[model samples]
Target chain A: MELQAIGVQHPAVRQVQHIQNNTAPNRYKLFVAEGLWAHNMLLEANAPIDTFFWCPEAIYADEAHRRAEEIAARAERSFRVSLRTMEKMSERDKPDGLLSLAALPRWEPSDLRFGRTSLVLVADGVEIPGNLGTLIRSLDACGADCLVLTNRKTRLTHPKVIRASQGTILTVPTVEFEETGEAIAWLDRLRFTVLLADTDEAVNYRQADYSGRTALVVGSERYGIGKEWYGHGYQRVAVPMLGSGDSLNVSVSASVLLYEAKARKANW
Target chain B: MELQAIGVQHPAVRQVQHIQNNTAPNRYKLFVAEGLWAHNMLLEANAPIDTFFWCPEAIYADEAHRRAEEIAARAERSFRVSLRTMEKMSERDKPDGLLSLAALPRWEPSDLRFGRTSLVLVADGVEIPGNLGTLIRSLDACGADCLVLTNRKTRLTHPKVIRASQGTILTVPTVEFEETGEAIAWLDRLRFTVLLADTDEAVNYRQADYSGRTALVVGSERYGIGKEWYGHGYQRVAVPMLGSGDSLNVSVSASVLLYEAKARKANW
Candidate 1:
């Protein structure tokens, strides 16, 4: 079993131990399971898991071990490992003994097609791993159809992301585009109204038409949107910042925009 | 200068010697000025700065450095550290050469009086320093009057909170509460309506009237606000989360709630 190869004694494991540098997950269309919370969240999301690992510490006594065994019995593939090794693999210092390599969630943006108009989030060149995770979580909570990442510098398959995303990346239609300008052009071709959140914009976010097939485009925290979208025909809206700060976290901005869209769509 | 004792030797002086850790800044109320961008934001926000540590590798070589010099000149106290020491103090290994130590801003909540009604963010028992920082940043961006942390498990003085706020903690009004229940009672006595964002609440956040003196209360990411408010007649409202993910980042939830309040206040 592939599970046996991951044990500490196995020599092949060391070569590919770094999940960030490993392409096997994407190549084989597999997603690494994180800690127990992510495992449980995936199960709750009904996303498929291919293999499961149980670290020794995950169970306290014989009774708990029996429960762990019972749960493992439900999985098609499962294994047991020492706490030390599992802790090394985990992002968190202390992890519940369970981890799983879930099957890559098959995602399709076309599935987001709604009969009525809706607001969607389009992230342009978001390089930060944590921000990507937070943005996906926000998109899912606000009922956005899909989040399209255009030319991300950070690898989507990075293990840090899967851990940070609370496994919501599985449920969200996580798609990517080669270039943001091209993505915007495709949206324009589809006649989807686009809005850019620029600090220099005149119109307040609340004044926009978020009830339709509106797409809110946000850029990286570092460079923001480049020459691609500037002075384009898209409406530029800014959240009314009444105080002294320049901007909010890129992910928090996404959440605020998506929530605003939800509110406007529902006509609050 | 006290800065010399630390022997600032790093490239981007601030990056090599970042005050990102709670230990450094919390101990002395002295934080390392991170980057030109951050320092610029600080200037725009009118945050107090005690000294400036300039490095040659930094833009001081470029004409842009001339403008930066103007800002540096404004520092109440300033120093010139060798690029070597700047590198030592810098966290960014490359070392842009400039590191500044600024006294943490001292600000307090103004008299809790709203002439024409208002919207505010009230955080309760939030333990994550990053979450608190994000909350403060969102409040600053959304134009929320202030963030009140009552019954907080994490110190508002933690450096992660400062870093997470992108330095807005200095610009925003942050008040600590001995007890969330007591704070709510005080608000009630002062005619401030308390809207607690609870998971079990039936009322949608949008449905609530935020045009009044509103305080949007959020519990920690762990267990939310303690049930003490349940005894009080506080209005409980939650943002409508329409997805399978049961939890959102407490800060993300705060952003959504704050913006809703912003929208209502604008209309009001």
Candidate 2:
């Protein structure tokens, strides 16, 4: 395959840079996945790659070079670029020489399927991209079905989210609701047992029933779950903080709760 | 009390910048704590503050101002600086008008007192500062007795660690061993049931006994635990990955295992 050589200022390269910088108005429509881990995961998941860019000089690892060839074969459009151009396109200090652009997977409430043993995660007002990504990774690790973001502060396509998620964001089904009410309505309609993680709550997380259809809700670090989330028949659960620190990190709390749910559901 | 006014180039200010930038040779001797949470936690722990620097104009919250006065009263030396100077010295884009320098607490194996039901965490070769800090925070939340670092990569006093730990690093008794053998010898003498988090292990974490004196060992994300850590009678435990992700974030894995130990020890 003859790969077209491109420079830093190439139209496609500029488009990728714009999307990465979040300077492009429709940035959320497409996302950039960089380096070896993301590339390998993308291939593992069989996700469609719109375009692939690789720097022969920058790819030092044998596995990376092999993956680059695989990506080039599968990508709709593939291009070769200099190491300098690759560095300019990469967000990390050290570029791994492979980058790809893919359309953001759009999911809706209707798209999510709930079964008798469904486990859903609702993250409300999570401001940090890295935290949101970590939440997705945890949700995935616990075998959760879907993620519903209410008052979502960061784009799911944000590079940090993709990187921190280790590309699990591509596998997990996620939807966003601008209003918390809409999300609540959907969960209610699905007959999901909603569990809100509250620091003040008396019921310990392990004590909560997680069998059957369950939805775990976690909020931002600074301002917790919205007040509207309360008085909605949702059970409040707390991870016991036995030390001087008042609360665990938001993602840490979510993972603990999710794992508890996982163990209970599995009867482990 | 008359507050000493300082310029950006003031000796104390330069010293802080040097420490924050990790440019000073003795950067590990003193750590910088910034923003409201760090300030409040530092005071709550009664950790000695070597110096406090405040920017009145940059402080927007009423509680911050109140805390400023309290910090000034307790700090060995206090200075008032312009917001520009504060921003220059701060690591975050938004400076919170409060910063402090404190001597890093040093602990030895002898300093740690293990009880019958002690929970100690051993983090090996954790390269990321934020991840290390998060590990400390999770260890604190689980009410762990102390943190033992073997083949430690990042400095515990790094600003990212301090911020991510929410100042729990200041309170947690942490000792680092350059050699894994020394750490193993100490744990053996203390009769701690060592549990290493391994991806290849078949023993599920929850099935493992965490009662009595316990130590949970987690390794760097890139590299698993050191080779010397194996064949030492330290039982290997694994968190079941029910989804596509091969492993959870190192901190997340540590927290889940720590909480599991916490619950099992308490018989919850």
Candidate 3:
């Protein structure tokens, strides 16, 4: 529980700057957040944050101080650092006093098993960290199976994605693949219906059966799941968008589909 | 069309950074993104956008270009800008030159009149811009009857929220309310079965009878519809979030409930 302010300024704090970069290929073993909510999320998640420093100047809500004290007590070690050190590592314009690096929870696809899987979501070519995080959060909310990802998309190792996920990324297991076709095939082998979302689909999403193990595939908003993969066993299913606009944000679209699937199967 | 670079270096953009900042209330009269897919949705909606831009750097198939050009052709006026401009406007570091701007659309609550008024979505205290946008996008996808917005949240004129709505905001005749409780009373007088989303509600969302005229009410995530106003014939309902953590993000939870209503009524 050693206390150290990890910022991008000081050589000691700046050392973790590489981890802070969203573009980095590997996940940061430690994540330093500037806000009270994020730090609390990590603490509540029991994420093994090795160390954290509470700044004297950091604002505390009514519950925040009590929670911080409890988190500090539980920390194998803790630090009471100065606001100056936090400023050195503060990535944003506003750097709060409480900075902590919680250990990220490890996950795998098998960990996402659901009872009688209805409509699970699969994402490919979603390269934006925030979009991916939002997608994961939606998947978790809609009770979809693991969000299968492709290497071509942004990996969840990024801190922004975790923040955007609002901490749900820690809960949602993912299945990533170099070959999306293989991923599709794997879903096919499992007898799960593969439904690809596109504008030109012959079947509307409502018409598609999501009452069983299903893989709803959504592509990057920029580039949809291309015909190369589209012609596979997948059935192109489009949501019935009656508006002038033809599509939803990738994550929102996925949410609609997931809600439909869960609703039907659950008879909600 | 007269094209203006209006460099990011230009001071005008940041003059009054937050349009919602009370002094800047007039900002709504200026350029505003009005629909879901405000960026992506506008294309589907053929919403009148000033231009189209994307980061020329991201790797994508020809479909991306084809779609971009298609959308541009449909815009009120269109042009191709550079990755630099795209980067400045887009949050994602990798610009897709898909940036666009359009005048916000106007709305009236009466426009949401539907068949037997079986289901509808009413959002109050929905302060988060992206959540509002995402909700609009989902409302369109889930085919909810009109989206209602009250004064408790971000201004609908914000471009980011419109972009998130994916053009649904453009299609849906959303009504604005200064007071949500008053609006609920109006719907109540109309005989709509009002359902309030509560984190502590005992009735599971799936158990609700969505077959009749139903109004789905949701509060802001940060401060859920304050407890002060409740129990006035507004049946409180809750979504069964399988995960043990915090409740679903507001937008996700709303989408789930909306689609569940869609499903039960669909008799799926």
Q: Candidate 1 lDDT, tens digit per residue, B74-162?
A: 77755566666665666676766455666665544455455556677888888888889889988888777677877778866555776
The digit string of per-residue lDDT tens for model 3 on B84-134 reads: 644455555454535555546665666555678467778878887888888
Say which docking band candidate 3 falls in.
acceptable
Please compute the TM-score of chain B alone for each predicted structure, in the order given: 0.81, 0.93, 0.72
- TM-score, candidate 1, is 0.84
Please give, for residues B1-268, the per-residue lDDT of candidate 2 as tens digits.
3698999988889988888787877734798889898888888888889999989899899999999999999999999999889988899889998999878778878877778999999999999888898989998888889999999888877888988898788788898898999999999899999999996855988789987899899998899899999997778999899889888999999999999999999877
Model 1: per-residue Cα lDDT at residue B223: 87
The TM-score-based order of candidates, best leading, equals 2, 1, 3
Q: For every model in order, what is the number of clashing pairs?
A: 28, 0, 29
- Pairs that clash in candidate 2: none
Best-fitting candidate, measured by DockQ?
Answer: 2
Regions of candidate 2 where Cα sits further than 4 Å from its true position: B8-10, B82-84
TM-score of chain A of 3: 0.85
Give the per-residue Cα lDDT of candidate 3 at B172: 68
CAPRI tier for the interface of model 2: high
Error at B156, model 3, angstroms:
1.4
- TM-score versus the correct structure, for each prediction: 0.84, 0.94, 0.77
